[model samples]
Target: MVNENREVTEKIINELLHGKICTDASAFSELHRIATWTNPYVDYAYVDDYSKKTIAIIFFDKYNDNEIIKENTVKAISEFDMVVDAYDVHSLNEANFYLQDITRTRLNALPISVIVYDSNGKVSPLNTISISEHKATKRTVKEQRSYWCWWRDGSHFEVATLLELSQKYDDEQGDIYTNFVYPEFFNLMIEGKTRKWDGTPRVKKYSTSSYKSEKQNYKIPMCQLGLWDVETGHITHKGESVLCVIKRYGADSKEFFDYLAKIILIDGKHLDLIKDLEEFQKNNTELIPESSSEFFILFDDYMTQKNSIGTRKPTAQKTGAKKAYVRDEPKLWNKLGIVKLQGKSRYYKSYVGIEFDWDRINEILLADIFGGSNEKI
Candidate 1:
């Protein structure tokens, strides 16, 4: 019976790899059952030919033993040089987003071979699932929506400024932003010492409202990380704690930057990515690129595997992840005294320094922040 099942599984996988859509629900179910028996946590599995590699995407409703699943899946497909991407999605919409991202097709237009298993373990063809019943409201051609990407404008200085500014405001009042915060921040930027522009000191003027841009770039992210109150625009206890760190060790200091890294990793909810990158670096040392642009290509693959869903288009999803990695996280690393930018350009050529000490810094930061607890912050 085991021999027969193994034969059946191989046949199904072969068919999938060759672009055959398995419409027979029973055969797909059997394949799913066998995959589940191999790793009980798998919620969905599908073959992807979107890229150069023949890839298998395994979905989970909750993250279980991710390494075990990847190991077993690799062993099962040992005959082929296939790549396996595993994602843990919390909602049906989130799962649907990944499906659309992988296939570059809407949920209603997906290939039949893509099977979906909901939280209750009910399996259905990918094409049959409806992400939304109501037709999307159409806008005029002139009123089209802009492509979405992860916001990445905030820096440590701006964050510190906002936090310090918040300390002067009453925490209970939510209406302090428009009247006080915006104008005050604008003056602070303009009236401050002349900043260097292209090797010359130049007096700067506010191009747009500082509040509008900073609110999106700084306030929203700070709120998301629990440093600022979303409604009140006041600093939280967490934010205050971070402010103390900033005051003790200046914003540019390594101690403060390490704390920022910890906050961004734990409170910003990116610990999983750090852990995954650690493993990826260990295994794929030869694959790591010297240039930042080239490095982002490799990063995007892992981002896709992790099912980092934000934008509507697959291209946007890739672009957005690359932008965040380059602009936000690595920029922070560059400031942390660990990562040294190589070139004169805003986006540097390499992160050679980060390659060596990333795991060490991550280990120390995680241990310090979580107090050695394995639980997700």
Candidate 2:
């Protein structure tokens, strides 16, 4: 037990040096860009024959000046606890830059316990603890591919999957962003235009999954992939979704999409798009449009119609001039899709996905709620 204590503390120090420790849900969503390392407490670790659970940590450069770190870190741990079988917490105030980092890792272990520190330096939040061993689900690597969206309302979320303005977003300020919103992380797309995806010569020599070299085993990148939608949420085909609180109970595809369909981007098309958005908002409305036409928003003009302001779309638009904005017949906005910012759409703004999974990280969160195995997705 004494040796175990030493080992755990050593791991905790590593995590604090590299992982993000955040408290806000929306903030974490945006922290997707700044994260340096992923901890098992939030990323995939172990979960049965299929499905990997995840936990995310947001790192702070100076925790004292930015005291929110304590709250955010605590919130992160609690959220992970609810979804994960178990996790670990440690401070790395003593870490040196030359060494390796290992912050916010979750490990599967018997006799698991939560350790919190007192302002006075006392650690170990639990006075009495219970530790238990977990048997592996014996799932093969391929069976680990499945996972669903982590709703905004869900207990904890995976931040590695979305795009944002560096931080969750500041509704009051126009385009004002937090420090974490933008980081110097190497963006592959932006880099590919100038430099190769990776700077390493060996990496350049090897083809990515899309272009596998007959010489080696490689995986294709999922950066441009779509969001996961199981029974809980719907992943848009183009993959731009404004996450909202999820209904606690699970939902079917029809019922789930119904919720998203209500919140469609109704503003932005040059001419007409509101008519379709208004109808799409209704729960009972059947909107199985022809497959040829993809869904989209017309623009703020749709909201200007006094009757359309807060209510759902008109039951049906009057064919002629009476229809302020017409839901044009058949066309999808593929050229440059729109983005939702401050409850409105910004036309022609593109989006991409960012994922954080640590098959390479050595630690695993022993979170009991999620079972002490590494969960993947």
| Candidate topping lDDT | 1
lDDT of 2: 0.24
Off by over 4 Å in 1: 1-153, 193-204, 209-211, 246-255, 278-290, 312-326, 340-356, 359-377
Model 1 poorest 10 in a row by lDDT: 30-39
Tens digits of per-residue lDDT, candidate 2, 1-377, equal 11232233334333222322212122112111111112211222212111222233232322322234434444444333212111222343322110111123332122122334423333332212221122222323331221211111110111121222212432323322112222211122223311211222122222353232211111011121222221212232333332322232122222223223222211111111322243343421343222211222322242333222222234423333223232221111211122122213322222211111222111111112213222111
Clashes of each: 0, 48
Q: Candidate 2: minimum summed lDDT over ten consecutive residues — where?
A: 215-224
- List the candidates' TM-scores in order: 0.47, 0.20
Instruction: List the RMSD of every prediction in angstroms.
Output: 13.9, 23.4
Local accuracy by lDDT, each model: 0.45, 0.24
